[model samples]
Target: MNAEIDFAPLLPLEWLAVLAAISAAAVVLSLVLRSPGWALRGLAALALLTALGNPSLTQELRDPLPDVAIVVIDESASNAIDGRDAQTEAAETELAAALDALARDPDAPMEVRTVRVDRRSESVEDADQGTRLLTALEGAAAEIAPDRIAGAILVTDGQAHDPEVFSNFPAPVHVLLTGREGEWDRRLALQTAPAFGIVGEEVDVAFRVEALGDAPEEATRFARVEVRLDGEIHTVVDAPVGRTATLPIPIEHGGSNVVSLSVAMREGELTDRNNAAVFSVNGVRDRLRVLLVSGEPHPGERTWRNLLKADPSVDLVHFTILRPPTKQDGVPVFELSLISFPTRELFMQKIDEFDLIIFDRYRRRGVLPNAYIENVARYVRDGGAILIASGPAFAGVESLYRTPLRSVLPGRPTARIFEQGYRPEVTELGERHPVTAGLVHENAVQAAPSAEDADPGEGPTWGRWFRQIELEATSGQTVMSGASAAPLLILDRVGEGRVASLASDHAWLWSRGFEGGGPQAELLRRLAHWLMKEPELEEEALTAEVAGAEVTVTRRSVETTPGRLTAASPSGETLEAEFVEVGPGRWQATIRAEEPGLWTLTDGVLEGVAAVGPPAPKEFENPVSTGAVLAALADASNGGVMRLADGMPDLRRVRPGRTAAGRGWIGMARQEAYSVRDITLTPLAPGWLMLLLAAGLALGAWRIEGR
Candidate 1:
């Protein structure tokens, strides 16, 4: 309870002041003239003024509120290293007991609030922002009023990624570090990783093995690092620690090329997770070098040229034998076409330079000898790609099957030609193949094949072709069929190369919008990419995708049933997972990934790697516990820093603006915050009492004046 004096004037203040001034002047004049009863007149005036000024005694009943103290605990991955978690829990328990003790204090009580910063408690949105200790502290303090916040205490490894610094805190902030002194850590850090690199070229990835804290001199001298390309060990390199080493990784094919680097784990280091880092660089072709050789001038020849030329990235070298050596032409040599075909330079000298070779209606026309055709077959075996777009000539005496190229050719000509119009259909195997899967929907055409010459059953959804060569698929898988299910498109792998056979010249009919054009552009693009050995277009593949903490493994294969997949986590724990068929040939299985590192997936044949969280989690970047990260914050709040290894410090209540921390002790501010529960006002001067006193003084003045 508290008491104070207050006033409520009965008359206006201006009128009361005027009456007091007149009475004071009259009393002074009487004193100056030596008149009697001057003192009594002054007393009478003072009494009258006191009656108008209503004075009261105000009393307030207040309830003392407890000062709030927030404790922010760091439960991030970094805090889990080297017994820091145990230290944190101990500190939390000790601090809670201390706060409870302060709550029993009669002078200044405390309300303890705890906020834990952890990845498990995070939503998918802020999961990437690791170890936000200060952010959590600020959020916890926001709920408490500024005056009621006695102070905040943080128990962590001091690896906060949040850039927030509190310049003005309501009270002191103390930091209790969890780890011991002289702890060391070794980490693999990626300095420079290009987002893209040209296929077939080497991209220099810069990285370094760093020694943090008090790492031993011998441990920092040299480090053995393993370089992994696409999840497989590519090479082992001996790199000097603390210096940037550039590793040249060759881009073998187009699409995503993942490069993972790992330094050998030290026995006593902070963690092995940060010793490995993984990043992906997309492999792109500088220019697709394609050699398009046409045996004769045909209407469909322009279709191939237009498609290849439309892409600005393709470097097309087209050659047509308008007048072969056998043709007796009467035209002069100077009157012929400007440039001569460099057959020897292309086939013998620079054949390996081209990424893809296309033979459009090409037959044995004596322009290319048997040796050149054999060289072409050898090129396919040496990681080259070939597309054979055969016409009716494929079934004639001059067929390419008769040449040395037949060794790599996926199909053999049957010496039969179908002249009737037929709609091309994706085979049952092609429905699962990446190249032809969902091609029907992408064509965006619902019209049936040409009704006049269509097959008796429900025709294909695309347009019709007038002619197709009948071929027996001796090797490879048939992806498309025509004319009563004869092999129309066959794809195969020869050595390290790829071969594709499209047995129809009437593909141009679809390009010309014949009978509602099919997916000519889309189909040809996919076909070319497949022939060039694009990773996404592989017939058999193992792949994994990550969404938050779940890893979805997808297996695409041409086999009837894809077997189970064995997943090896970053910790080398293998798990056998069965697959469920989601699509035609695609099977998938999802696993919860609690770890944040590379996950290796394989089915004994194909292998793949997927990253669950960041390849190198930010939490483990600086796993060595220290007080430097929170030093500024503590100093700004006039607090102190101490290691839990030393001992749990005694908690004390200190006055604001004084020393809040000292040797062996930390302090919380003494906030006298309170709320008023009840108020009472007792009138000190009543109107009747003041009137009676004034009348008695006036009578005394009259008696003195009469005497």
Candidate 2:
């Protein structure tokens, strides 16, 4: 307990000033009138004033409070280096013990508040600062006022994200580094990478390799780097250290493409975690080439051309066989405005140049010989796509199914052609296939309408078709069905390529608003892209998207149910993801994500990658425990930075105006904080005593003035 004396006014200052003025005037009048009682008059006024003022002695009982010394512990990702974490633990233990001992002393007491900050896989706000200790320090300072703050001590690997946030801190900031003095690490760094690039085009990527700390210059001057994209290793070269090297990397496909560069681990390296770096670059297509072949002019022929032509990314090559040579009577080719068919060029020479080749009601013609037909088959089996829109001609003797191409065809016509109006519906398999699933019948009057009739507004059914050639599924999945529920759309894989068969060419009637005008354009567009092997349209696939702290996982398959999937974090922890069917061939679920980095997903067999959080976050950019990031902050605060690996320094307390650090000891500025618990005011004299003294003085002055 402590004691103090203080004064509080009994009356308002304005009233007290008036009383003083009256007393001074009375004394002056006695002196000017040559009265011998001038001193007596002054004495009476003093007594009266003393009684009115009521001055009292107040005693305050105060309880001393210890000064708070905050110790912010750095547990960020960089502290995971070889011996940094262990070293930090030891230093924390020692610092706590010293502060506790100081608190036990009677002359100088201190309070310790230790704040432990866990590692950050990545932080967006800390992206530019490189470390996150300052935010935590500012928070601690706000909790304890500056008057009682002994000083702030940061125990870290020396890398701070926001050292500039120290302006708000009233106390000095000291750094206690946690790594060895001579440790070395070799790291691969990405100098520059475009966030988006055109698929199949060479993109310029720059990178560097360098030795950190005091490692031998020769050892790092030349390092071997392994470059990979989408998990496939491709580039390996010995790159010179401390310099940027520009190389060409082809963007392989559309959507997210991840590129990772890693350097082989060297002996005695501090840590291999920072030896590699990864980044994501989105892939985009430049253009798509499509070849359209129409056996004869049909209503739907223009529909197909219009869909492809509307897309700016699609380059359409359309041809119409106006008159088959077999149907030609006496017409001369030169006299007519028709040009010779380019079968040899499109089918044999430049076949691979086209992304997709569509055949509408195409049948064997004398113009395209048996060899040319065989070339088309080979093309489909060699990474090319083919779509067959079967008509009554498919049931004829000259059907393309009777040629060598039959082996690649997914179905064969059965000579049973339904010529009645029938609404189209998706098969069970189509509900899970990317191409046919999720397709809405925009114009059809019903959802599950009758094949014979469609009402004004009911089930999902496309506009009625006049004809549907019956076909038997040979190999491949049937996605759509028509009249009597027979296969209307069939998809198959032939070697490395894909093939699709549509049973009718009357789909163009939907575009004419027949019934309601169906989703003919949408269906054909997706079907074409699927045949071209778009990754998102694959029969079996897993994908993930990230938004803030939530990660959405999607799985697509032809199976009846989408089972549980497992997501792996960069830290090697696996979490089960539950998915709900959002559409045919699509299942999605969102999960809480705490760690930021590359996230991998799998259904036991196939695996995919997605990055969560900021791009190339500064926290994980470098994992070495270096003092460079925090050196400036320590200097400006007049604090010393010392490595704990050498030895733990002593903790001391000093006066407020003195320096708070020394060669072997760190000191905290004394705040001299206290709280007043009780106060008592004592009157120096009785009120009656003052009244008697004033009367005696006034009488003496009256008598002296009369004499």
Candidate 3:
């Protein structure tokens, strides 16, 4: 309990002060005149003034409130290097013990609150913000009253990304750093890279091999960097360390083209995780140039034209055979209104300019001679794409199979035709192919036990084609079957090019909405893109998808038994990914990602790469720890940064403006905080007592004057 003098004024203080002044002057005048009762008069005046002032005594029942000392611990990725983790653990224990000892003090006690900031606690969205010790410190300080805060202590590697956040903090901030001197690391840093590029075009990428801290001379001179495109080793280049170098990488195909670069690890370096970097550049086509050759004006001819024209990215060049050279109609050449077909210009001069060539119901005609037909065959052999949409003429005497182009065609006509209507079915192989995968009718979806449980024999229930040309698939996989299980669609790879054959011309019926229609447009689009060598439409593929720390590995193949896939993590540890059949010819497995970096997966035949986080994790950007990051912050708060390697500092309490840190000890301010539990006010001068005192003093003065 504490007592202090307080006031409860009965009259205005100004008026009271004036009356006191007048009484003091009269007493001084009496003293000058040698009056006998001057002292008594002064005493009476004091009593009256005290009564008017209303003096009171206040007593407070108080409870001492403990000051708060916050300790923020750093456990980020960088803190785990070079024995820093153990150092941090030891420092944390020492600080906690010291704070506990201080809490036992009877006069000045403190409550210790520990806050931990680590990479694992950070969300995927905060992955870019490295170590945020200041953020955690602010949060802990906000939990208590500002006046009750003693100080903030951070036990970390001193690589705080947000160090300047606590300039005006309420109390001193001290840092106990981990890690020793002479630490070093070599890292691969991407200075500039494109997020996307045009397919088949060369894009310039700039990067640097960085040497941090006390890296050796060998690490700072020249380094061998391995560059990989789509998980396969593309090349090895000698890069000069500490300088940016530009490399030209060609975008192979459409879709994600991941380019990964990793430098050779140096001995005694901090970590190998920062020695590698991975980035994905999306490959996009400038424009899809398609050449559509129609043998005759058929009902399905306009369907292909309309579909290709609807896409803004496709540049379609169409031609129709109206008048062949063998036609015997006698007419003047000038009088004819037909535009001559530029067969030589399209088939011979500029055949390489087109990305895909579509022969819609086309057959061997006199307009395109045997020489032009042979040129088309040569075109397919040298990294070109051709799609054959056969009509009845394909099985007749004018069949394209009879020409030199038969060498590149995947199917051969059997001189037979099925005129009956039948629904097209996707073969078992098509279920795993990216183009035909996951395409099922609504009825098929409802009929299955579940969405993933597809019936083997079930196909899409849509409009039926009235006619199909019978063919023998000689050199390709049959993806679609027609009436009576006959090959309807065949896909094949000849040398570096691709070929696709669809043995029916009634696909336009579906576009006409006949019998509720079907996925004609979708099927055509996928088939076209697949023929153009789109990477996503490959027959066999290995890929990985990452969501947080979980990685899902998917293998797509036509074979029934796909062996176990081997995955190499960024840390160079190999893990086996077992497969379970999720659908026909498709298998999947999910595993927990051990760390964040580039992950390479291979199934002997195909390889793929997946990145679990950003191209370069910020935590590993500067692996060697030092006190430079938090030095300014500590100085601003009147604290010092000390290394735990020397020894744990002694904790002490000091005044607010004094130095909070010295060579051997760190100090926290003495807050002296308290709370008033209860307050009682008692009047010091009562009115009756004041009046009696005044009358006694006045009578004394009167008696003295009479004497």
lDDT of predicted model 1:
0.86
Per-model TM-score, in order, reads 0.88, 0.85, 0.87
* lDDT tens digits, residue span 131-189, model 2: 56888888887888678888878889877767677653556567898877777777676
1 versus 2: better TM-score goes to? 1
Candidate 1 residue-wise lDDT, 488-517, digit = tens: 999999998999999999899888988777
Write the number of the candidate with greater lDDT, choosing between 2 and 3: 3
- lDDT value, residue 558 of candidate 2: 91
Best by TM-score, which number? 1
> How high a TM-score does candidate 1 get?
0.88
Q: What is the lDDT of residue 28 in candidate 1?
A: 98
> Which lDDT values do the candidates have, in the order given?
0.86, 0.79, 0.86
The TM-score measured for candidate 3 stands at: 0.87
Steric collisions counted per model: 0, 10, 0
Question: Candidate 3: which pairs clash?
Answer: none
Q: Point out where model 3 deviates above 4 Å.
A: 10-45, 61-68, 93-111, 121-125, 146-148, 214-223, 240-242, 332-345, 427-433, 438-461, 547-552, 558-567, 574-594, 602-605, 675-680, 694-707
